[model samples]
Target chain A: MAKVYNFSSGPAVLPHSVLAEAQSELLDWHGSGMSVMEMSHRGKEFMEIIHDAEHDLRRLMAIPENYRVLFLQGGASQQFSMVPLNLLGEKKSVDVVNTGHWSKLAIKEAKHYAKVNVVASSEDRNFSYVPAEDTWQCDPNAAYLHYTSNETIGGLQFPFVPTPPEGVPLVCDMSSEFLSHEIDVNRFGLIYAGAQKNIGPSGLTVVIVREDLLDRALRITPTMLNYRVHADADSMYNTPATFPIYIAGLVLKWIEEQGGIKGIAARNEEKAGLLYHTIDSSGGFYSSHIETPFRSKMNVTFRLRDESLNDSFVSEAKKNGLVQLKGHRVVGGMRASIYNAMPIEGVKSLVHFMQDFARQHG
Target chain B: MAKVYNFSSGPAVLPHSVLAEAQSELLDWHGSGMSVMEMSHRGKEFMEIIHDAEHDLRRLMAIPENYRVLFLQGGASQQFSMVPLNLLGEKKSVDVVNTGHWSKLAIKEAKHYAKVNVVASSEDRNFSYVPAEDTWQCDPNAAYLHYTSNETIGGLQFPFVPTPPEGVPLVCDMSSEFLSHEIDVNRFGLIYAGAQKNIGPSGLTVVIVREDLLDRALRITPTMLNYRVHADADSMYNTPATFPIYIAGLVLKWIEEQGGIKGIAARNEEKAGLLYHTIDSSGGFYSSHIETPFRSKMNVTFRLRDESLNDSFVSEAKKNGLVQLKGHRVVGGMRASIYNAMPIEGVKSLVHFMQDFARQHG
Candidate 1:
């Protein structure tokens, strides 16, 4: 069978080597005589798996000594509520920049715990461009400023991290683009990412929070949702997502072997450039509405010149081993989510299919 | 290499067949050309997997049509707070029957949301037995009566389901023994189980709530913790634990092929009986503190006549392919957690080792 290039937003494609390694150890992990899935979270074998995963992630991201890396469950969506529940402190409101679907969801959940101030929103322009930092209304008394580093649905990535007002922390939802590039850990108070994209699987969520910010959780917050509880226990406040963490550890090792984050960033840029170049050179047959400067390097979104050909373009592309290229239901067209694990060859195959489909229809 | 018997409480042993099948399909699921982990939650492939899992679980448990089976993240420990947050609507308190460590944790979390009434408690006896249901102090105004069906740490299982007062609903945490026996779903207003034990892997939680009970979630409940939100979206409110859910689906299928819940219950009984008989025949060499009538059929806890030999007993058992027999750290002794997936052969091997260890130490 031909290997298919998966382009689903998330759960997205993973490195073939990681999957093969996991398959080999599915039933017996390191001669422990138990699948990573069946081993107790508190057992020595699983403890090492989780510990090594955290260590590798810290090394890859260059996380500071004071930051607590929490492997949580419930994906990034749960973090939307937990952020407010844990960080709202004495402040009555939070500042949020609405880039697209995910940021909006975060704002909605934050409103349940505190006053939500949508400082800036790109929705006015159909989320085709990110609002400039200068245009954002900073709230001096707000708890924190929140933003999505990349909008998976709109195919928009913030060109630069927003600078929050002095004393107010900056929190980022880096779910889709985490680990694709090097990041400065000191710049943000907290950073969270769902593992399905670049990390590993769907169940595990990676939360990196500064040490001093752990104690601000609301008293009514559930123990599992409290960052302090997780930080205090080293993210073993509960059983945790054992198998997912194990797989994520393997992915982190893979990242290191592939030249760490810097290497991943260079390859990612090349893949995005190749696909975007194809769209640009298609003589308007394939056009991208996103402003080039703010366009996502992870999810490349484009549209066929004749809207009627969209269905055929997607279906025909699947026959040639390109799958999950259909745009999000809310925004119809084409989207190639080239996450960290998507090789250069996969993007090239997608670009070739796009050009051939455009020429045939044109 | 010979297969070894695992007895960790959870994430405990899964059927070898389930692990083998998962290993074979880790890279490509049924020719979809994508690992189940890579499929989008909204895609038809994942939709089918989740739907089939929920359907099989409902059938196996004989769940009523009005019940909504929700596949949620955050283990049962998270449900500790969610229970009170969602069910303690107008009521200011909840009735709780404390059986062991898990029940104590639930009560601790419940106190954050509502006043907790200790209707009954076995903590007075070091959680060695279940408090009599007839002796429970019924709270007419309480939102619900919460109890743990099986205490994993103490190795105690409730012999009978507690009947809540006419208007009060019954809620149960069946985490450790969820699918090991036949359960009448109508007996309770809600049943929740962490999937690490009998279901599949860690991270995925199953909540079977009666339809009418969904609307009781408090206004302050986090969106992810709210049952109504999950029910409305059919448990796809956001990116779920995709791979965990898929593996759980396979587990449910395995349960069906083994002749459903009834078959699993009979096998569990035989396994538990064999282990208990071995302990009883050892006379003063082995002793179980839990009373025979209320002893668990899942986790068989016992202490050697010479308590100082605990370490060697565990080490010797491991050498003989019986692992994780050391008791929970909190309650030191030996605990063999024989869940639904533990075969009769594994139990026999464990019994044989226990007899030999007792003879040598006696």
Candidate 2:
């Protein structure tokens, strides 16, 4: 069957080979006489699947021995609430760098549980770039400093990890760009990512938190929402989304087959670089408002200079087997989310379509 | 490929045809050019999938317009916390009847958020039967009355719905018995089920709550845990368990093909009857202690009278293509969870194995 290049920001493109392998085993996984979904979560088959998923993720990210990897549900949005509930400890406030769309959501949820001290915000310039580090108002007495590594909607990337004052931990929501690139895991106190973007699918969230941070939940925290409850149970406090975890395990293997984090990052660099090059060299025909230094390689956003041609650009691109090129309504123009699974060929096909359309409408 | 009869409780069997159909469409659903797992939850394709799932479920169960159906996460265990937080309203206490292991868990979680009144408990009888309804000390001023429609671990089920005092709402955790048969949704203020039992898979949870009961959630309820938040957003408050919901929709259609709810109920009655009859006739060879009238059709728990035969029974059953017959530690017996997807043939096979083993060991 022919497959199209999918650029959906999330519930995004998955590795083609991984999908094929899952299809072949949908009815019987490794002669187990059951689909991955039908297996008991505590049964040996699923135990190994979850075990391997956490193992591979930890290996790929170089997660330290002091951290516990929790495969949780409820997306990064739920983490927005859990962050303050678990990490605020006895302190009453948290410092956050407001990069763009995703950070603003984190801030809103944080304010519900703690005093949010906005260290700095790039919103003053329509969020085109990350505000300079020297401008950030670090709170020495704050419990932690939080930031989004990648703002999936606005396509802005933080080029550097923010440093917190002594005794204050760092946290990040790396949903869009996790596993696409390598990073030092020791810097952050907690890191979480929704699987839909670059890992597997919706319904699974990966949280790697330093073991010491496990306690300190608020008095009113729901048991399920408390980090310690899940960590103690090895994430099996309940049936832990068996099917998605299986697929994530497969994705982890695919990540290794692509030669681990370094290889995936290089491939993502090639795909994003090609698409952005097409946008850049199109002269005034195509425009990207984000400052070049802080643009995201995961989600490449741009606009057709003649906005009236938007429908034709997206629809006509779909006709040529490139789909979901329309950007989020908040950012409104075009977004080509070229994650690790997006082959250079798909980005090339998108680039070819872009150049031809620009020539015709220039 | 040869398949075995799976008897694990909760993350149990799914209809074979549904699995096959999902396998066929795993790569490109309806030529949408992406796997169901890959489709954006907000996209048109996913919208249709979720819309049809809710429609078919409503049709099968005859759910009323006064209730809102939500596809959620965190499983039924999460609902333990959600129930007390959402249903306690202005009342100081809630009434509950403890039947088995599941009810006890619900009671434990409830005690954290509300004043819990244990109206009755069958635990005194080792949870082998439901305590007499006449003995229940229900509080008329309680916020709502809570019960477990079925206990998966003990294989005990309620033969009839319990009525709360006038104007005190009724809530039920029907996780293990939902969709095995139909019931009057009007009797309850809220009903929740984890889908792994009979619907689809582990990650997604199905919730049906009266719209009027939606507003009683405590202020501390996380936005994602609030029924009103999901109901208002049509369960897309954030990205839901997309793939599980799609598979659940397929299983709902399969239920219709197998003669809808009435047909399913009759089939369940026949399977449960055959297994129970076989156990009773075995005399000293096999035994089930649950008062026969209250035995669950979904999970049939039994034991070989000779305790030492336990390991061989499970291992032999596995060798013969019947698996996961080991019961929960609390029950100390064999449990064959013959859910909706479990064919009558699987039960017949178990019965045959039982009779043959009895003759050899007797």
Candidate 3:
């Protein structure tokens, strides 16, 4: 079967070469006589796999020594609860910038444990743009300042990382845009991403947290939710998502081959650029609801000027082997998630199809 | 590369056919043009896969209509906290039989949330036997009776499921023994098994909860840890372990081919019988510490009488394409886990090799 472009938000696309390599080694991982899935997490073979995975990840991100990279199980949503449960230590409140869908979700879950100070919200404008950091009303005494670096649903993203008040740790849900570009690891007190997005597969969440923040967990925090427990055990407190982590290792290797973060970011930029350029040039036939500066390079959400053609547009795209091009239901428009693995050719094909669709109906 | 029989407790061996199928479709799943890992959890393809997985699992167990099956993350350890947090509703205590290592782990986590009643224990003799049910001191007012169905490290197993006090729910951590045989699902209010054992890969945990028990979660239960939340959303509260669930689906399909629960149980019994028979008939060469009728059919633990040959025994086994044969550190001998996926041929080879080793070392 010919491969087609998968534009799923996540569990989303992974690299083709990574998949090919995984396929070739699925039965016997480097002659260990066991699939990576079957190998014990504590075994020497798997220990090297995980160590190299962490080493490559640390090399990719230049993660500081004071920070611990934890390979975890639950997706980003679990971290929403874990963040407040673990980070709220003696403080009763935390600051959050409500950008869009994902941010609101984080805020909602955090509210269960901590007093959530919603510093700023873009919801008044249907979450189309990022609110300037100057407008944020952060509480200086807050435990931390948390924000979503990218909101996939509204296609809102910050052009710059927001600054937290003095002594306040900055936390970011880098789920959708993680590793799409190089960012200063020092800017974050903790950074977490669900592996499904730009990483490997779903189930394995990567959390990079500063050492000092590990012990701040509330006593009521579930043992599994305690960052320090996982940090201490090197994230092998219990059996991790072993197979997913192995695939993530392969992906990290692929990222290295593509010239690490910068090279892949360049590729991501080109793919997103082509799709966005097609949307911008289509004279009212295509429009992105997001503000120009805030548009996401990962999830390019756009709409057909003639809304009634949404079904035909999606069906035609499927016929052309461009699948999962439909938008999230909450925000009704097409979402083309061109993550790191989406080759430039897929984007070109999408741009070509967009032009043809616009011409046939324009 | 030749396939070795992996005897690691877990993440353990998966069916050869399942791995083959996954390899064949790693890049393009049935021409949907998306790998199982790449497809969106909410998409039609994944929905069908998860649905079929749950359906087959339910059929194999003969689960009643009132049960809600959830495909979850965080492994069995997460369920340790979750069981007490969710099931200890209006009650203040729960009954648990201390069978072995896994049971103690669960008790330690549960003690944080409830008053734990030690119903029975086999720890006095290094967990070599299950305590008789008649000796239990169950609390009638307790919320539930929890037990480990099989203890892999100490090779202990309950010959029969323990009875809960009248009106108290029976909860079992069937992680090591789930789906290995037929059981009366009606007796259990909740049964959870980490998928790596007798199932699929690690990280994905299967939970079967009687419907009425879903609403009993304590107020502080993390939304992700709440049984009702997963049940209401059909375990799609967030992006689940999609690829692991897919592999588990294939494993369930393989189980169906093996004549479901009963047939697989017969194979497991025969495998264990051959191994135990070898140890018993070896004069004073290979000795099993576990008491008869209380030994696990899943993990067959034994030691060479000399004990000095432990290293050589493991190394020799590896040379013969039998790997991961060393026992867990807590139990210093050997553990040959003859899970459902371990074909009869593998067990025969293991028995034959064990006899040869005993004769040489004797």
DockQ category of candidate 1: high
Q: What DockQ was computed for model 1? A: 0.82
Query: Which model is ahead, 1 or 2, in terms of DockQ?
Result: 1
Among all windows of 10 consecutive residues in model 2 chain B, the one with the lowest summed lDDT is: B1-10
CA-only RMSD, every prediction: 1.0, 1.0, 0.9
Docking class of 3: high
Per-residue lDDT tens digits of candidate 3, residues B62-176?
Answer: 9999999999999999999999999999999999999888999999999989999999998898888888788999999999999999997887778897788788999999999
Q: Each model's TM-score, in the order given?
A: 0.99, 0.99, 0.99
Using Cα atoms, each model's DockQ against the true complex is 0.82, 0.78, 0.83
Off by over 4 Å in 3: none
Query: After best superposition, candidate 3 residue B89: deviation in angstroms?
Result: 0.6
Whole-model alpha-carbon lDDT for candidate 2: 0.92
Q: Could you give the TM-score of chain B for each candidate, in order? A: 0.98, 0.99, 0.99
* Clashes per candidate, residues 3 or more apart or on different chains: 0, 0, 0
